[model samples]
Target: MKEKNANSQSDSGYQRSLTNAHIQLIALGGTIGTGLFLGVGNSIRRAGPSVLLIYLVVGIFLFFLMRALGELIVSDLSKHTYIDFIEKYLGKDVGFITGYLYWFCLITLAMAEMTALGIYFQYWFPHLPTWVPGLITVAVLLFINLLSARLFGNLEFAFAIIKIVTVLAFVVLIAFMLLQGKSTSYGPVSFANLTAHGGFFAKGGIGFLSGFQMVIFSFVGIELLGFTASEAQNPKVTIRKAINEVPVRIILFYVLAIIAILVVIPWDKVSTNSSPFVQTLGATGLHNAGSIINFVVISAAISSTNSVLYSAGRLLFSITFNEKGKWNQTFGHLRRQLPQNSLILSAFMIEFAPLIIIIIGNDAFNFISSTTTSMFLIIWCIMLLSHVAYRKKTPEEELTDFKMPGFPVLDYLTLLFFIAMIVLLLFLPENRIAMIAALAVFVILAIFARIWRKEKTE
Candidate 1:
């Protein structure tokens, strides 16, 4: 049997077109999405100002997670995606299972974003159907993705700039308000708001724990930088820099922004029904603040959908590359040096967003989005385990400089942290069903993988 070269490109034609700037912005754009723009209010309402701590804790673990992944990518830049590393280190069946599971979750995530896009559009155009905006947005994004990887990077770059500017401007404006001793309908803009309501853990320990599910969801796409390595201009420099900046991005974008909102609106008064960004801006008497924030939120959703589609397409192509069968041949090959077929199939799957919305109504978006957090927790655990395996198999001298800090100890600790979060999700009543459903999907995939292995052997 021939040894599979971990550094060999699985497919022939992916262009190394994503520059450092593109990779940086893509990392920024992936971490800041509708979850932060629209869903933070729910987290705040659940955990109070302690949500700050929740964000910080989750951010730290995720930074460690990225370090493990960075080490893997730096060790083998020629591999198309992290899935390749999984296959190499953790058997072919596990790789097959993880790849398809990841692709499925991404498609569902894109659908949720599409559903949110429709709702955001309804804010301005009340008469439009909920699905129309989502359908149109998916169509346009699919077109952009099909054009080329560079074009996709360019669009994400533009979208990320809009998000970063909005967040920075909000934080700065809130700081000025605090310094000026500003007053709003709720109360004065003061740091006291953070603790005055109920001493930080306003909702008690349960609320703080409950906040993890959503906050963890907010960071779902952070690993997207791993997917970009195959197409990135220089994997070592660009990937390492992007991963190293995870902590800074989390603090600046999530922690500071949430702190600003809490200072302006007491934890008890923060509306869980809508974006705190829109609420904070509106309270400040900014003319058309709601409209402007709405536009930004819409762009955030589109940015998420675009990035997920790009990942889904590549993942599908990677998993199916060089496999036997008509389906594999069709999706595995690149057209015009791009994964056009795989991309089209992924986009087409997202078109079901409208039908899902029509069938399940508004709950569809929350249900789909919630399920992804549970699914990703499982995937992250597997990736961490794969990292452990890689370390055990490779001699120390063969390892790259971009190694995971604390080596074997921190690696196991990170794995345990993720496992604890998974257990927490199962205990939460609202998320229990979603978590169980995700587990069922994993089991089903494992069963299929077994059959697939048997067939391959035969």
Candidate 2:
């Protein structure tokens, strides 16, 4: 299938120890996280049952986006990350900006997960300090990550399994409850709950539109499959498999799970302050159901933080690889074949989440999450543009078998979807500040890129 060193080891010193199973679960781990567990409540509060439509729309576009990325990864497997493809096809300037921006994106996302960790812990230990759980989590995850790539993959494998089983069980329980016509405090568990509450568009068009910000945030780490390309055992097969399953993952993990929650609790009744999963389970009057789901959501948040930290570390290493300067030299190189320094630095950055909590208090998670959603939307737009440039520049005969479906058209559509979402964020009163801040970061990075280029030339 026109392979070009598709299984070759990366020159960047990453070990290809992650097998097909690891890759699959890591993809699952990335898709289902604090965004789904905790953030879904926010989305439900905003859009009601219409949030399902939002998830479907975003999922379809992202699947196409991953196909474009899979083609790039298989086309030249030796590249360390998607940023390398960006640098090659879109020019070093764009690469420089995107690399740092993506690193910041992952870091911000990690912070959001950490913030969620505090909230999750509060369900059990209301009197404990909010920052205590996140601090301990970052410390433990950092050590595991610094050990080796395979170890990180193994940990994610276990975390993903926990999440999958819990979600599936929840869905099945809800279905059984519906079939029996069981009644909760709210009402009978039935699909009718989806439509009975405000006729599905209870919040109207603006509310539906508002859900996109957090729903998009929930899908932020989906591209983590791209970062694992270098470390995956068989890049072409594993990455393609992972990317191809995006639709299924979206349906199972997001669509069905959210449906279960809505059918049981009604969208308007779902708690915006905590995980709706816990709330739904509690409504069933199952003993310890609330506590059990709370534990699962905590695990979900930790799993997300772990995955993002892994990506953040690799992103930092990729961005600084072989660059000049003391900081670059410190974080750019791997130790014992692991990106130890880079991971440490990324973990260090995550420690700021607690400090952010101190400053913004309860608003920290939403603020950090909104900022990440804005940044990632911009990053996704750039990645799609790079994919388009790659196709135009490369000869038809040289392309891989995994080309993006409906080339150029679907690509442009995907780009438009993301850009429109960005515009939506800009207009939303709550997200407007974060959107503008993201744009400011982009402009600042562009200026630095110009100056860096000029300095190199002189």
Candidate 3:
């Protein structure tokens, strides 16, 4: 009966075309990509079986964080996404920082996915040059995004289905191998691999802690769900279902999938250079397994890249929609009811990703992974803090139905977890550069915000 954010329409008049299926699939597609398929190998190498627990722990905190986000968004159905909530509950300064930081995060992340996509393509055509596919992927997805937001959602649905099929198939293959009592070069395909290494915590506490940086990165895009609130066909029902199922999706897709890989193949045998999923399939005497899995991974990367590009556009548009800043006004404009201005600019930014891959080669993934994990953690911190502030301001009766469990306590604990994660990043040598970079970006954004506010006053 009531219109949520009657004035919340995008400059291009975006339609609420994303159904429950679209939002759910987009959430799955966004979070379950390179992090699980490609990055998990490095995590396995660092933490051994302990990586499973890391996923669980980080996932649990993320659940609380999302719960906080869901309640915030539901409280004002008219609001498009969390950016509005951050601005309203927090301050405009904070809202500005959050919006730009989120945009930057998705841009870098989309680039990372593209980098991985090229590497996967090389698995089939080693001589074709990584940048070739990288560029083409960006162009194709850019075109799709420029057409319509609904098309982007539909494309994500297809990409997500490919990933869902691959992971499901991989898990089934593992079950079949265990049933047959088959053995591979790594020895028996059983759960023994989980403990057979140096015990479950084979790598010790330090190694286990190091994995959190990447583990956190793997879950980076889960918050994309909150951003989709504006386009959701039924925000109340769709957002509710999507956010509620996040933990279960993490368990089934992330936790169970990793466990199955470890069970079938010793963690030590998995190579960071290639996907553990690809590696496991190849290890099962499937000669073309590498090629097959490569195709699947290519699809996964494409899926992730597509979603983030869409996210980057929306984030940029949100900033411009709320402010009169020059760049915001430019990026915020729409044509043919699409954020074409923001979408093309975001795509252009992503084009540089292919160059980064060619320059650094394999290290591109590692660098982007570390940098983004730190950045996403910071974003989560703000999200939770904003939620707390929102709760304090709103009447208890208003949040009656979409209540966040463990409100103040869980909220505080989630914030602490994020702080601990930032501290942990400092101790990690590989992540140290990323930590510094994240800090520098935050400082720069804050100073810029201060100047903008001062000028506005004058």
Best by TM-score: 2
Task: Name the candidate that leads on lDDT.
Answer: 2
Model 3's lDDT to the true fold?
A: 0.84
Measured against the true structure, the TM-scores of the candidates, in listed sequence, are 0.96, 0.97, 0.96
Clashing pairs in 1: none
Candidate 3 lDDT, 179-231, residue by residue in tens: 89998767788988999889999999999998898888888888888777777
Superposition error at 188 for model 2 (Å): 0.5
Clashing residue pairs in candidate 3, if any?
4-78, 5-78
Name the 10 consecutive residues with the lowest summed lDDT in model 3: 3-12
Whole-model lDDT per candidate:
0.88, 0.91, 0.84
Q: Give one digit per residue, the lDDT tens place, for model 1 in 1-458.
A: 12223233333468777778999999887888978986788788989999999999999999999999999988987788888899999999999999999998898888878887887787789778789998988899999998988899999999999999999999999999999999877779999999898899999999999999888888887898898877776667888998998999999999999999988889888765457788888888878988898899899999999999999999999998989989999999899778899999999999999998899886776777789899999999999999999999999899989999998888899899999998999999978999999999999999999997998899
**Candidate 3: where is the Cα deviation over 4 Å?**
1-12
What TM-score should be assigned to candidate 2? 0.97
Across 1-458, the per-residue lDDT of candidate 2 in tens digits comes to 33324344566887777888999999977888999999999999999999999999999999999999889888987788899999999999999999999999999999999999999888888887788899999999999998888899899999999999999999898888888989897888889988997889989999999999999998998888888887876778888888888999999999999999998898888987788998888888989999999988998999999999999999889988999999889989989788899899899999999999999999999999999999999999999998999999999999999999999999999999999998999999999999999999999999999999999889
